[model samples]
Target chain A: MALIGILGGMGPLATVDFMEQIIRLTGAARDQEHLPMLVANLPHTPDRSAAIIDGGADPLPALLEGIDLLNRNGVGVIAVPCNSAHHWYAQMRAHSAAPLLHIGEVCAAAIAPQVTRAAVLATRGALSAGFYQAALVARGIEPVLPDREPQECVSACIAAVKADRPGAAATHLSDVLDALSAQRIDAAVLGCTELPIAARELARPAFALVDSTLELARETVRYALARGWNRPV
Target chain B: MALIGILGGMGPLATVDFMEQIIRLTGAARDQEHLPMLVANLPHTPDRSAAIIDGGADPLPALLEGIDLLNRNGVGVIAVPCNSAHHWYAQMRAHSAAPLLHIGEVCAAAIAPQVTRAAVLATRGALSAGFYQAALVARGIEPVLPDREPQECVSACIAAVKADRPGAAATHLSDVLDALSAQRIDAAVLGCTELPIAARELARPAFALVDSTLELARETVRYALARGWNRPV
Candidate 1:
C-alpha cells in the first residue's frame, strides 16, 4: 500500500469527513492494512472569501508548505480535501514533484457524464473567482451560477458549515437549490464540500444533485487502487 | 485584525479538532466578527515519517504551494496544525511573505512558566525529528523523551491516531505516561495533538499534562483578540 499524505483543515469537519470516506472506501480489514498517512491540519488560515474579496489573507502558502512536507516524506501521491483551494491548483501542481490528485477535476469528471448543464452552488467568492466555472467550461459543460441574493445565501451556508451549524447550512443550500430550479438548470453541483451535507437533505427526486466531495473520495479510491496502493479483494 | 490562513489536512480529524478550538476560543457573536479564515485542506500530502525515515517522498514543495496560495490571497498570518510539519518551519517561513505561526513555539510559550523540565510523549517521527527539542531548547527548557521501547510504543500510538483507533491510541499514551511516572518527570507534554485526547483520559491529579494543541488554541484566540478581530463582549 502507498503512503497517503493529507493537507487539510479548510474546515475541520470537512477534513474529518474526507478521512472517514477514505477509510470506508478502502475497506481495510485491520488498522495496519489502512494506508500509512501523514496529515498537516493547519487551521490558522484566514477566510478564503475575505482574502479574495476583502484583501484579508491567502491560504496558498501554507498549502504549498504542506505539499512540500508530504513530498519530502516521499508520498507517491497526494490529495487535498478543500474545494476553493483548487483555485491555485495550477501553481501548486507546478511546484510538486509527486502527482497531486485534483478534487475539482475528479469531481468534475464524475458528474460530467450525468449532466450537460449544471448550476454551481458555492460561495460568492468561488463564483466570482471563476474556480469551478473554468473547470466546467473546459469540459464542454455549461456552468450556471446562483444569482446575487442566492450567492450571498450560499456564502452564509458555507459560514454555517464553518460554525458547525448543519441545520442553518442546509437551509442556505435549499435556498440556493430553489434558485437553481427557478433558472431551469438541469442539475446543481455542490461546489463547496460543506454544501453537500445540506444538499443531501434538500435532494428531491426531480432534481439531480452532484456532490463534489463524494465524487472526489470515489476518485481517490480509484486512483489509489489503480496505483496498486490496495489490491482488489 | 490580521486574517488567519490555515493550511491543513494533516489528518481530517485533527484538522476539525483545531477548527473547533478556533471557534470555541474566539469570542464572537456574528460570523463577520469572527476572524476571517482561509483554509486549503490538502489530504494528498506524502507521508512525513515514511519520507523522512524510510526515504519515501519529499513534502516541501506541497507545503510551499499551500503557503503561496495564502500569500497570493493576501493572508497576513499562516498556521499549520500538524506538529510533524513544523520540522520544516524555518524553510517555510523563509519562503513565505506571511509569518507562519509556530505550533511548537506556541506550545513552548504556553508551558514555559508552568513546567521546568517537561517530558515529551509523541510519535517516533516527531521525537526523532527533534521538533519539540528544538523548540524547548530555544526557550531555555529541558526536554525529556521516552526511552527506546516506550518510544516505539508512542510511535505506535501515533499510528493508531492516523488509523483512527482512539481506544488503542489512548492506551498507548497511557503506557507512555506510566513510563514517564517511572522516570519521575515533573510533567508530560502531549507533543502530538492526538496524544492530548488520549492523555486527558489517563491524566491523574498528580501528573501535569501540557497540550500543544490547546495551547495553540488559546494563543490563536489571543492573537485574534489582540488584532481586534473579536467584538468586545
Candidate 2:
C-alpha cells in the first residue's frame, strides 16, 4: 500500500477535517483497515492568498520544503487540503516528485456529471484566482457566484471559522446558502476547506452540498485503492 | 520549531480529534504560527485492547514501525492519542529516539491539583493494564473505577463510538456519568479519546468533565512552546 502525504497547514483545522473525512470514507472496522497517511502540517508556510493577491513573500519555497519532506519520507502521492493553496498547484507539482491532488479539479470531476449549475463559496483568494471557475467550465458546469452582499457574508463566515467561531460562522453561511438556494442553483460547492465545518454544523438535510474536502477525501480513497492498499471491511 | 510526530491510527478518528484540538489550542491566526506536525497514521497496527487484554497479536512491530518513521522524519516528540496504546508506552519509548508523551501522565498532572477524587471512563484494555490508575496514584490522586455493570456500559459505549454510532454511545455514556454522579465523584476523566466526542454531543453544562484528549492537546502545545515554538496571537 502506497502512503498518501498531505501537504497541509495552510490552516491546520482544515487538514484535520480532511484527514477525518478520509478515515470516515474508508469504512475501516479496525486500524489496519484504514489508509496509511503521512501528514506534514507545516503551518509555518507563508500565506498563500497574501502572497498571490498582495505583494507578499512567495510561499513556494516553504511549500516546496514541505513537499520535499513528504517525498523524502516515502509518500507516493500528496494532497493539499487548502483551496487558496491550490493557486500554486502548478508550481507545487512542477517541483515535486510525487503527484499532487488538486481539490478543485477533484471536486469538479466529481460534481460535473451530477449537476449542470453550481455555486462556489470559498476564500477571497480562491474566488479571485478562479480556481473552481476554471475547473467548472472545463467540466461543462456553469459556475454561479454570490453577489457582493453575499460575498461579504462568505468572507466573514470563512474568517469566523478560521478564528474558531464555527457556530456563528455556520449561521451566517446558512444565510449565504439560502441566498444561493433562492437563485435556484442546483448545488453548492464548499470550495474553501473550512466551509465544510460550517456546513456540517448547519445540519441542513443534504441540500446539494458538493464539498471539495469530501471530494478530495473520496479521491484520496480512490487513489489508495487503485494502488492496491484496500482493506477488507 | 520541532515537529510533533503523532503515532496515530489506533482508531483513526481519535487521531483526527487529537490533531484538531492541537490546532485549536495553538490559537494561531495564520498557518506559520501553528506547530508543524508529522503524523504517521498507520491504521494497520493491531488492536491495542485486544492485544493487551485478550492475548491478541503483538502490536509492537507495527508500533515500532510508526515510531521509527517519526524518529527518522525529524520529529522532536511523539504523542499517541489512544489510551489503550499507552500500555506499550514504555516499550515504545525504549525503542524510539524521539521522546514519548504519556497521555495518562498528562491527564493526571492536569487533573491532580484540581480534584482529589475522580472516576475514569476508559477501554477495558486500559483498565486491565492499570494505565491511568498507576498515573493517578503517582500524581497523589484517588482513582475510582466503575463497578462491573457500569464498566460493561463503558466498554459498550466505547465499542459503539468506534463503530461510528456516537449518538447511541453518547446516550449510554451519559448513563455511566449519571452513575458516577450518584456516587458523588468530584470529576470524571474521559480516559478514552472517543468518550470526549460523545460527552460533547451530550452537551451537558460543565459537569466537571476532565477530557484526556483536551489535556493531551494542551500538553502538545506546551511541549512545542517550551521548545521556543511560541507564536504571537
Candidate 3:
C-alpha cells in the first residue's frame, strides 16, 4: 500500500481521532500488515476557519509546508481531516504532488442514498464555507442547517471539543442535534472532525449520523487496499 | 517548540495514544500554539518483540528507515512508543542524527521516587528483554513480575489490545493487575505501550500506576519546550 500523509493538527484532538480511526478501520492482525503513514501534526498552522471565513491570516503557506514535508518523507496520498479547511482544498491539491482526498465528498457520498435531508454540525467557518453543503447538493441530497440561535450553540460545542472539553461539548452538540431533529431532518453530518470525540455520548441522536472523519478513514483504507491489490503478486 | 519525531505504529493504536497524550500535555489555546510533530506510523515495520526476544526477523533496518524519514523531514528529537522495542534503543540511537527519547528510562525515573517494589505488566518480549526492568533497578527500585501463569495472561491482554479487542483486553488486564496486588506489590508499571488502553478500567489497581506511554509523552513535551526556551527569544 502507498504511504498516507495526514495534514493534521487543525485542533490537535481531531488529528489523533482521524489517525485512530484509520488504524481501527484497517484489517491488520499485526503491525507489519497495516498501512504506512506520515503525519505532520503541525499545530502551529493558522486556523482554517479563521482564515477562510473570518478574514484571518491565511493557512495556505503552512499547509503547503506540511505537504512539502509529507512529500519529502514519501507519502503518496494526502488527507486533511478538518472540514472547514476544504475551502482551500483546490489550492492545496494544486500545490500538492500527492493526491488529496476530499473528506466532504466522501461524507456526502456515504449519506447521499441514506437520507434526503441532512443537518450538519460543524464550525461556523465550515457552515459559511459551504463545501459540505455543496457536496451534499451535488449528490442530490438537501442539506439542512440549524437556526441562527442553534448555530451559535453548534459553534460553541465545536470550540469546546477543540479545547478538550468533551463533556461540555456533548451537552451542547446534543442540543444542536435536537434542534435539527425538530426541523424534521433525516440525518446529521458531523462535519467538524472533532465532533466524533463526543460520538459515544451522542447516542445516534434522533436521526441517522454521517461522521466525516469515519468516512475519510474508510476512504483512506480503501485507497491503501486498492494500491496493495494492484502491486505485483 | 522544536519538531518532535515519533517513530510509531509499533502498534497503531499505541501511536495514537502517545500522540493524544502529547496533545493533552502541551499548554496551547489555539491550533497554531501547539507543538509541531512528524510521525511515521509505519505499521509495516517488522514486529520488534518477535525480532528481539523471539529470535525472529530483525526490525533494526526498518527502524533505521523510519528514523531516516523523520530526519529528512526535519525532526529535532525522536521517540518510539513501544516498550519491547527499547531493546534496540542503543542501536536505533546510534543510527539516527536526532537524539532518541528512552521511554523506559523516563518511566523508571518517574516511578523510582514513588515506589520501592513495582510490578510490570508487559509483552513477553519486554519481560524477557529486561530494558524496562533494568531501568527501574538502576534507579534503586525493585521490580516484580507475575508468575508464569499471570505473565502469560499479561501477554494475552497485550495481544488483545494490539488486535483491537479492548473489552476483552480490559478484563484480562484487570486480572493480571489483581494478581500483582495479591502479591503485595507497591506499584505497577504499564511497560507495554498498549497496556494503558485498559488503564482506566484497572482503576489504578491497589497501588499507583506508571504509564510508560504517558511518561514518554511528558518527556517529548519537555524536549520540545526546552528547545523553545533555547531558541533566540
Residue range with the least summed lDDT across 10 consecutive positions in model 3 chain B: B224-233
Model 2, TM vs. native = 0.90
**Location of the lowest summed lDDT over 10 successive residues in candidate 3 chain A:** A224-233
- Candidates in order, TM-scores: namely 0.55, 0.90, 0.95
10 residues in a row with least lDDT, candidate 2 chain B: B224-233
The most accurate candidate by lDDT is 2
In angstroms, the error of model 2 at A127 is: 3.2
List lDDT for all candidates, in order: 0.70, 0.84, 0.83
RMSD of each: 9.4, 2.9, 2.3
Output the better candidate (2/3) by TM-score.
Answer: 3
Candidate scoring better on TM-score of 1 and 2: 2
- The deviation in Å at residue A106 for candidate 3 is 0.6
Model 2: per-residue Cα lDDT over B90-181, one tens digit each: 89999888789999889988874767778988988898889799888787778899998889888888777666778888888978987887
Please state the CAPRI-style docking class of candidate 2.
Answer: medium
- Residue B207, candidate 1: C-alpha displacement in angstroms: 1.8
TM-score of chain A of each: 0.90, 0.93, 0.95
Q: Each candidate's chain B TM-score?
A: 0.89, 0.93, 0.95
Candidate 2's DockQ: 0.61
> Which of the two, 1 or 3, has more lDDT?
3
